[model samples]
Target: MSHDAAMSVQHPQDIDQGHVVARYVSNERRYLKLLGGGFLRLGEAERAAFIAALRADALQVSPEEIGALLGYEWRSRLTAAWLVGVARRIEWRERVGELLLASELTYAGQGYCFALAQFGGKNDAEILVSYLDRYLPHLECRYDQGLALGALLRLDSRLGTSHAERFAVRDGLWERWVDALPHTRGTADAWADASRSRIDAWCNLWDA
Candidate 1:
């Protein structure tokens, strides 16, 4: 046999082992894309299988590879955070921290912070708190702050709420916002106007 052909050959027992080597451990975009439309469109059994396979593959990837996802597209970032959270991938938590610090404070950034909370212990929560301390002053919109606060509450309830005084909109206000979010649905412009009005009110309250 040619050397290449010889290398390709495997014993029956070795075939299963060889298949394992071919399995994906990273490149999340590729795996999720290969699932066709997305995980949500899959049937129940297939979705579970896909999730299980992704979890297994996530666990196999190096911390560095997982960390790299902090800088990737939103889907990849969310996936990385989910994997880190479930796997308790402590070694990669620093990368999540970088995401928190570098975040643009948009909806996408809020999701990144939310996913990051799933990864570590008290110290990780503390890091977020500290970051928020610095982040609060320059914040212009309430949309992202609402998401960040919710994640912090998940992290450490007492500590997170302790900082509530610094927020212009209290939990009660957010509760009201959620109640109001659905009413503006029929018109996109109405939705935007209402959202802008609420955001402005929150900003003005904080500024005052």
Candidate 2:
């Protein structure tokens, strides 16, 4: 699929099961379908919204059950990875990050690295950085370093707009970011401090 085609997918907001927490406890069939494929095979946006809605209101349920969705099946596996990577729950982060890191699937690794950068601390960031260095591709459509950098900036604002100033996305940022920019690096650092100059130099190319 073209980047535009891949990104056109929207969240199935119409499928809201009213009070996401209550319905899960009631064992609603639609909830399972929402995660699986009821309306029309949950797309990235739909899955992301499902996770966000659940995280926002479904705080009472067992995270393990919610966690199970990640590996329930390969068809929706990316959705599960999205849940693991973006969930605010610490347990989710730890479990998913570790699992994704070891996964033979590199696509999942991108999301895993992003989550680490968002919620991880020093060690987490280091792990994320090392993983990116070892696995992230240098060619276009495969480089997702922007997420790593964005996560670090989210973690530490001191890095400043200097980091995003040159980002090639002049119009905006959205789902297609993974395929929009061509970023490749010879090395990476979890702590912006260790590779301060290099990061700045690399980010400088955002405008180039």
Q: Rate the local accuracy (lDDT) of all candidates.
A: 0.47, 0.41
TM-score of 2: 0.41
- What is the Cα-based TM-score of model 1? 0.51
Superposed model 2: Cα runs more than 4 Å off: 1-52, 73-77, 81-87, 103-114, 136-143, 158-208
Clashing pairs in 1: none
Residue 68, model 1: Cα distance from true site in angstroms:
3.6
Model 1, 155-202: lDDT tens digits are: 554334444334324434333333354653234334334433432332
My TM-score estimates for the predictions, one after another, are: 0.51, 0.41
Model 1 segments more than 4 A misplaced: 1-43, 71-75, 104-111, 136-143, 157-208
Q: Alpha-carbon error at 161 in model 2, in Å?
A: 15
| Residue 9 of model 2, lDDT score | 22
Locate the minimum summed-lDDT window of 10 residues in model 2. 1-10
